[model samples]
Target: MPETPSALPPPSPSSSLPGLRFAFGTLTVLPVRVTRWDRPAARAGMLCAPLVGVVAGGAAGLLGAVLLLLGAGPLLAAVGAAAVPALLTRGLHLDGLADTADGLGSGKPADDALRIMKQSDIGPFGVLTLVLVLLAQVAALAEAYDGSWAQGVLAAVVSGASARLAMTLAARRGTPAARPEGLGAAVAQTVPVAGALALAALLTALAALAGGALLGTYGAVRAAAAVVVAVATAQSLLRRCVRRFGGVTGDVFGALAETAATAALVVLALG
Candidate 1:
């Protein structure tokens, strides 16, 4: 008898969600269709970053509120607030942050650095980076916790939005991923300047609504600074990637996002 052809596997769940598609487009080390967004799509995606931020922030705020209601100490509340975003993103940034630390610290050739990052095991650099990142995040949360719950929520929103904006900047400035098809391509094709500006405005408005002049100014400054840092860092990474592997990768983008978010929150807290 003639054999029937094998059935194709079902499409992965990631193929369904726009956000997940975008995330995969931005973070995966493979090639992807980076050219879906026209100006509107770009704006939509950029704006979506803050929307995700708002959702994540609201969750963090709720977590903090519940913890407080349950008689958990301020420290725990702060930690929970920080952990919520990390958890929501499934520690994507944390992994990026860790890989970045290991890659950059190794001082090996770019290929070696990328290889180290791809390794499943965490290195000394990864551990140290995680500690520093968590420490900074915890301190920021602790400070934000002193204010009203609104302030905590605002902090979470600003941090999340600013990180995406930072990623946009990186996408613009950094080299494409080696594969020519993954997140790097999609982001480079889709993310636009106008959308980033709109996100900034939205973040500013949200901060004003949440805490008036003080928080508004602080959030704006923090976000702007984070963007600058993220762009610069991403450029540096891009250069390294090109020199080593001929292009950027998902890991690099993730690292940039996490670094930018952490810096934004810390600055907002300090401010």
Candidate 2:
């Protein structure tokens, strides 16, 4: 018999790079303790989110620029930017969207509907939800593209940051996880509202400084819209989760972030 291959070593922990660990720990894994803003660890993690947004947004923006440069048209650029983020996050939100759709579509009791959501297999309702959400996103992006690289980059960054902010807010509100334990629970309990607000304010100011009043206003509005949608959606989902599964889960939180982000972008484009 062939020998089993050795597993890769876990990532090293570094005090100097607490932000990376916080981001990775809160977003990607289930840790016993999520760093708190009052503590240095939570502050470090808070920084990680915006940094990730900037890097991811920049890359997506560059791809959009390339598509435009190649004469691919605004629609293509929109699609590419949207697709890049989805791929980067490995469709985490999309999966949540799908699950939520399936749960909601069943018309069954809350418990039964949630059980359906927990199933790994996608249902017909999930497929329809995915299609509609993607269509809405593509349409919004195509309309927003104005043949300007700066706008594209700003749009990407704002969308990403706003979405992450939504997630942070949801966690702060005590949305429970469906499973007994996970990163979502830890994040919800650990991240501070003040830090999130501060980050949003700083990012808004930076956008205004970099892009002028109109651009800054747009970013601010987008962020606000994202927060509203996130909060409302989280409340609705949390209630449903409580009725069914007795609490919220990491997946629902991811779904809330994606939905809010997409809605915020659409609203910004329309404005």
Candidate 3:
């Protein structure tokens, strides 16, 4: 039998370096050099996924702050804030959100839904999902920044990191791939459960501390709440995908990331 992605060994010390390169090269438009593309490298890449989120989120936060300083106002600043990560990631997560919507909205058998997701054309479901989600993200960012630019920046970073952390959780051992080939198969069930949980906890603490530093007690509490909700939303989506589509596809991962980010932003905005 062919070795499955789940069968790949845990990432060793030497593989960790290549994994970092692979994570950035594949997940973002950062001009990083990736010399390894095998399963071990991909697994390590999954472990390093949140680091890419850190870079992307940090840049977005910085850009939003600069725009605010330039008198761009919250709305334009929000747009720029939201647009940076999308452009940097080539809107890869958005594409996943669209595809997942299409698949789920098809309301067909698992096989049929998977087939729908594989189609390159965007469906009505996809169009609507993208419109609503993007609108929510922009609106939430605007509101969060209305109070303070520092709060907005912290929120953006938390949302991005939270979303990537969701990916790490979903990829935890035993999660199945929706198909036998493609990106999903290459990464499915690659993350170790214990390691992912530890990372998630660490990120939550760090985000809360940063939020409190930037926005005070209320901000820290709200930030932590947002991260919790975001992770729950992502996990919920992953479960639904498993039941509806037999397992997770690359699109599912994308959808989780986008949904988690939006949820985090919205929670921070209103909480």
Candidate 4:
């Protein structure tokens, strides 16, 4: 369930084009062509991941808002919002989450666990985890929508963006990949600590502004908290996956995204 790297065409000659291509190319089902697979591009892509998340999550939120405007019930709007990110990513992150869950739940040695993760079939743990995670996501969204459509949109965007921001932190220099091949290997430890921290600060500020614009000062605080909580939750999972699996993997990345998104939703749902 790792991100399938696009085959290298000629590298882009522009300064920033390759990274933008890499971010959208691998992180979404967007039509952009990725022309570079080098470390520099991977670094740029990792840094740009949150931007991709903003676009994807904003799209998802807009869809939900449109549904609500069309007289759809909160539950229906919530479902639409929940479905969009999965559809947008071709469920890539969900598949990764399932695989990571299977691996972590196996109670086997690291090698054995990695082997379990590599299997195509969904194990009981993976299935249960997926079901529960999706339920939590949907339920949280519904709650936000019930409060107000603006809250629902805010939750969706914040959760989505925060989810990818988690990866930026994961990719900070010094984080190791679990294996020698795959998406994790390609992007691991690609971001500088300063760069990650700066982007995180910017994201948190934007979250506050989004919340303030949508709700109020309280909303701004909560929105910022949601990002913080999401990142913290993802970081916990990343550390655990690294320890259990010997390092980060594509599946681990998926797990972190889902975890962060769900955590953000949960925090936003709190009254």
Candidate 5:
């Protein structure tokens, strides 16, 4: 017999707490204690991912602004901005990016590729990809900071939020998991496509508003474009990874986030 609606358990004391805890717990080295690991919590966490990015990126941007105030050059400030997210996440995303690169670059069979990604060591492809991606991020951030400290900060926040937005969309329903276990399996296909789209629209609007307030009309256009282009780039990678790996993995998510961040920064760097 099916359980009636009233037979369901009472809602948590704070309905949002579980999601918040899950987001911070998994995405960052935050102190939040995750009270749930089920699909509901994962759904809410993925939906809230952009906010997590905003906070992490906000910290990164603030650090860059602080360095600037201390008379550091734009390059140094940019480096600081790039490093904070890594520290906050315990470099998990970077490691994932490296592993994903190795896996995809090997051109081996799907099973072999998955095994490569599972290993702890980084390959030459991973090293090269990491170097190029990091260089691109730092150079773009340096250019933005040189333009203005506000622009630099905006770049960091926008890219951070957009990066996680990519991850959120990657978790939308119908997306498959490459493995039957691990983080990807736990969170994959947890987000509704409509929900993901709505979140994206909301974030894009906020970016436009904030950009206009900070950098004027041109800034608004660039900010919106950055989000759009970043999403497009991430989706491109998503399609390719699905073809190569047969589905999504935790490493693929990391690659998407990094790619989105780098794309956003590059767009913001444009004259």
Candidate 6:
């Protein structure tokens, strides 16, 4: 009895699968069972957030390709390409964008801005921002499609994935959560800045390689530049959110993602 020792506790279960499941489940309308709802799982979800975009973009791109092959006009194909992700994701990011716009456009104090963002109804600012961004996306994609369907597809996929990368960057360590709880608190400062930067760079490199394989040297350059634009856009938005709203919120994250995606696509179209 004098020599008796305490036993060690069992290790926690791996959260990778649950995190992936949660990411897809929360970020999209896909059927995924999220088994873990704790912070660790939430962090894991954020880490793998970009994968959801890849899947959504790939599916949307395929639909656009099929539409184009079926004699659809570039505009029509672009609409389908834009619509599929919205449908699959239930436009969560779009809704977030709208809320953030409304909040920021109010030009109120930080507390008031947060309150405005939390409201369920969309305001004039929200409506206007959504309309303009959505139009820009479709118009740019249509132009890219006119050049080549493959280019359009690549642009869509790259922008989609890059959008989520912004979220990862925003969540990097030391980022402040906007509130005591909710998505911002759950994921803010969860990712290491170095890890986020590395992941984003890796994504850009992979996109460049794919562009070179599919399109050419110019496409590769454009692809890399587009990533840079997207990341810059995201960081700019994050800075504004922190200055204007006190910290990043779920709505801010949404706004950042949509803004990054739109900017990336615009750059690709221009290229």
After TM-score superposition, the amount by which residue 206's alpha carbon in candidate 5 deviates from its true location, in angstroms, is: 0.7
lDDT of 1 by residue, 1-271 (tens): 2111122122334333544434434333224453443322332343355555566667776787677678876678789988887777678778877877788788887678878878898899989989987888777776776665555666666666656655665544223455455444444424344545555655555555455543565555554554455445545655665566566566666676667667766766765
| Alpha-carbon RMSD, each predicted model | 8.5, 8.2, 1.5, 4.2, 3.4, 5.6
Over the stretch 39-69, how does candidate 5's per-residue lDDT look in tens digits?
7677788888999999988999899999999
Please give the lDDT score at residue 141 for candidate 4. 94
| Model 3, span 39-58: residue lDDT tens | 77877888898888888888
Q: Tell me, by TM-score, which candidate is best.
A: 3
Tens digit per residue, CA lDDT, model 2, 1-271:
2111122122235432765556655554334244432234543564466565555556676788788889888889989988876776778778887887787778888678767877999999889878887887777666666637666766676666656655655554344455545544444434455655676667655544544543566555654554455345545655665566555666676676567567656765665
lDDT of 1: 0.60
Which number leads on lDDT?
Answer: 5
What lDDT does candidate 4 reach at residue 81?
97
The TM-score of candidate 1 is: 0.72
Candidate that beats the other on lDDT, 1 or 4, i.e. the better one: 4
Supply the global lDDT for candidate 2.
0.62
Native-referenced Cα lDDT, model 5: 0.90
Residue 35 lDDT (model 6): 91
Question: Which whole-number lDDT from 0 to 100 does residue 218 have in model 4?
Answer: 95
Clashing pairs in 6: none
Stretches of candidate 5 off by over 4 Å are 1-15
Query: CA lDDT, every prediction?
Result: 0.60, 0.62, 0.88, 0.88, 0.90, 0.84
On the 0 to 100 scale, the lDDT of residue 75 in model 1 is 71
**Cα displacement (Å) at residue 149, model 2:** 2.4
How good is model 3 by TM-score? 0.96
Count the clashes in each prediction: 9, 5, 0, 0, 0, 0
